[model samples]
Structure formats: C-alpha cells, structure tokens
Target: MVLFDRILLAVYSLFFTVVFILFSAVMLGWPVPLFLLKDIFYPGRPEIFWPLMVILILVGGRLFWSSLHKPRGRHVVLTESALGEIKVSLHAIEDLVEKVAAQINGVREVTSQLFAVPQGVGIRIKASVTPDVNVPAVSVEVQNLVKERVFEVTGLSVSNIRVTIESISAKKPRVE
Candidate 1:
C-alpha cells in the first residue's frame, strides 16, 4: 500500500491496542490507570456524547465489515477436458517459471510474476546473470523457454513473457 494507507492502519491499530490494554487494566482493578483516567461520557454535554457515539459507531461498522471481507485469490480457469474446468493458481505458475528461469546457464538469480490476461497468462521475469553472457540471446531464450515450458506443463497458453535483466553478477564462469 501507499504511505498514507500504511500510516492510517498503523495509527488505527495503535489506538485500539492502547485502549484495550488500558481497559484490561481497569477491569483487573489496577489503581494507576483508574486514577489517571477521567469519565468523559458520564451524563455530560451532547457535544462530546454525540461525536464520540458517531466515532464508535464508525469504528464498529469498520470492524464488522472487515470481519466479513475475504481476500481475492489469483487464479484462472481453463476448460481443458470434458470433465470440467481446471483452476490454476497464478502463484504456482510463478514458482514454475522461477524454477525454469533459474535453471538457465549463466543466470545467477531469477524471480518471476504471473498475471492472468484475457488472451492467456502474462509472465514477467527478473534475472541476474553472469557478466560474460549475451544479454539479448539469454533474454530471448528465457522468454521462449518459459513460454514453452509453462504451456507444456500447465496446458495454458502464454500471452507473453517479459524478461528484465535486473543485474549482472560479478562472478565469472569457471573453467573446468
């Protein structure tokens, strides 16, 4: 998330955490917290009462909504056979791509991401390779090999494969 969202979540979490801890202390009959706190809601003016009620209502509503929310999983369905459709998780595809890409000669490190597209799946690969390797040839090889392998293994057509040579490894290939 962006900076503001992270900050807001942190602030909201901290506020609730502190309030709960103090509440537990009060329930346990801790003298320090009980003495220091003032009763802000005890038969007071409507200004404080209504605004605090609104804030609490909003907080409760947010909590209830969050409790019912479910995170969306990244998956795609392909109708391959007469039985039914096969569902493939994008994360599993990413792992397969990473393993295949890292097995390439002269590649020091490999990472991949898979996205489901209308045409098919789109793969983005980031790799660190040895400095002596030809970047253009390796990039093309990576793309072709990844595309073929994914389709061969998963029966899913790959719309495209993007390779980003993120860095060149300083270590040179050793002579046998």
Candidate 2:
C-alpha cells in the first residue's frame, strides 16, 4: 500500500509539473489560448481563456494531489471467521464501560483507559472507591461490570481488565 501510494504521488507530481510549465509558457506570451478556443463556442480573444484555463488546471491539480496523498477514512474489515478476533474503537468502548461501572454500588469515580489490540479490547480502570468500600470486592465488581457492558455494547470480549486503586479515605476521623 505504501509503495502504491508513493507511485501515485510521483505520477501526480509529474502531471502538476507539466501543467505548471504550460501555465508559465502561457504567461510568457505564448498564444496557446487562441488554439484552445478557436473552434469552440463563444469564440473570442485568447487572453480571457488563457488565465481561466490556467487557474482551473492549477486548482484541479491541487485538489487531486491532496486527495491522493491524504488519508481517506477509517477502514475496518471483519470477516465471520475472524469475528471474535477483532478490535474496534477503544474510546467509544471506554465510554460505555465508564457509564456502566459508575452505576455499580460503592463506586466513587470511574476513569478507564482502553486499547484496541489484536486479541480484543484491553481495559485499564482507575477507579476511586469510597472509604468504607472493600477495595478487592469493588475492584472485582468493576471488572465484571465493565466486561459485561463492553461486550453488550461493542460485541467484543474484554481481553484484560486491570484495576488500580489510587487512594482510600478513612470512613471516620479519630478524635483525641
């Protein structure tokens, strides 16, 4: 693909180079425009057609060149045989996971990071649990919640769910 793109870019560059040369020649007092509009409808002096054709060619070439070189759009292809072995957009999946995890009990704040890998989606959840909540139990609940929600929404399995506990607060302050 890269090689093909390079070849296309070279061809486009050559075409533009030719057009530029022709435009420069016209500006240098060449009577090429007379020949272009001599037989066409609305025959007139070559002066008007010369600059118009030059502008059209320049603009058209630029548009074509850019379209050929620039990235087109997101292209995702998944076959039935490889249906369970694909990775989709992680950002979208993460949004769904966060929404579901927040609804779970004892979940203070849910911050998730997701990555699209060959096997499937890899999830890393950074959740702040309430001081009174069990850290291990909450982590397990979050993992399950995220896995279920991500699968339901995206139809892809969660490869790995890593939960990190940032901090734990005391339920009550001790008095002296």
Candidate 3:
C-alpha cells in the first residue's frame, strides 16, 4: 500500500479505538458527553453528516475493492517453435516442487513459491524438517530433486532452487 493508505488505515484504527474507550467509560458511569456525541448524529444535520458519510464510503469501498483484486501468477514460456508456442503455469511448478520436496526423508512439511528470473524460473522451497535430521544434506537433496523434477516435467530451466528450513519438528518413533 501507498503512504496515503497507510495513514488512512492508521487513522481509521485510531478512531475505532477511541470510540471503544469512550463507550467503555460511559458504561462505567463516567461523566462522558453521551448526549452531545449522540446529537452529532441528529437527522437534522445533513450538511455535516452527508459529506462525512460519503468520504467514509469512498475510502472503505476502495479498500474493499483492492482486497478482492488477486494478482496474476507468472507463466513460463516452455517452447516457441514453428509448430506453436507452449507455456506452463508457475502454480504447476510450485506444486511439483512441493511434491518432490515432501517425498524427501527429512522433510515433514513443504511449501513452494516461484519467481521469474533473467536466466529462467526461480523456485523457493520452505520445508519443516524432522528432528535429528541433517539439514545441509537434506537441503542439498531437496534442491537437486526440485531442479531435476521441475525441468523434467515442465521443460523449463530452473534458475535456482533456494531451500529454506522453516522449522524442525519433534522426532516421532516409527511403529513398524
């Protein structure tokens, strides 16, 4: 968000916080301006009320509309030949990366994100490893696995595979 949006949200939050505290004080029998505050909302004051309502609605509508707008994912150009052009979804690559990484012995949970690069596509894999597992070994295996599988399936060159060990899970003994 831009600076104006940040300021607006901050002001909006502060306004609600003050309202909450004021209402709490009133409920506690404090000498609050309950009648005066209510008078500010009197139906006779259209001149002041309408402009404030319109401003609130406009700002609120913009925020709501922006929240609904989803960003489009990047697509990789697989091939451009005389026959035709072929492209693959970055989502597909991420799915493939997650699946391949999850199959590795040390990984407990896997998540992947993709980005476009000058050389090719970049894959970032975040994994939760099992306790007592070798991190460097598992990371290397995951990196190699993702690179090979993604290229094999999508025919897109992988610029880099960055493996992040997000967390390590507690070890559980195998029943078998």
Candidate 3, residue 147: Cα displacement in angstroms equals 0.7
Estimate the TM-score for candidate 1: 0.63
Per-residue error (Å), model 1, residue 14: 8.7
| Best model per lDDT | 3
In order, how many clashes per candidate? 0, 0, 0
Per-residue alpha-carbon lDDT of candidate 2 for residues 1-176, written as tens digits (9 for 90 to 100): 35655566677678668766766776788978545434332326466666657765775676577666765433232334644644455556677777887787777567888766788768888877677788899889888888887777666788899999876754332456
- Candidates 2 and 3 compared: the better one by lDDT is 3
In candidate 1, position 132 carries an lDDT of 84
RMSD, every candidate, angstroms: 6.8, 13.6, 4.6
**Candidate 1 C-alpha lDDT tens digits along 1-176:** 44554565677788779777877898998867664344545445677667867876776666656657685777878555888779888888899999898888988678898866788678889999998889999999999899899989888889988899999988754668
TM-scores for all candidates: the values are 0.63, 0.46, 0.69
List the pairs of residues colliding in candidate 2: none
* Local accuracy of candidate 3 as per-residue lDDT tens digits, 56-171: 78888776766676757567778899999898777887888888998999797788998777886788889899988899999999988888887789877788888899999885
Of candidate 1, the 10-residue stretch with the lowest lDDT total is 35-44
Best by TM-score: 3
Full-model lDDT for every candidate: 0.80, 0.69, 0.80
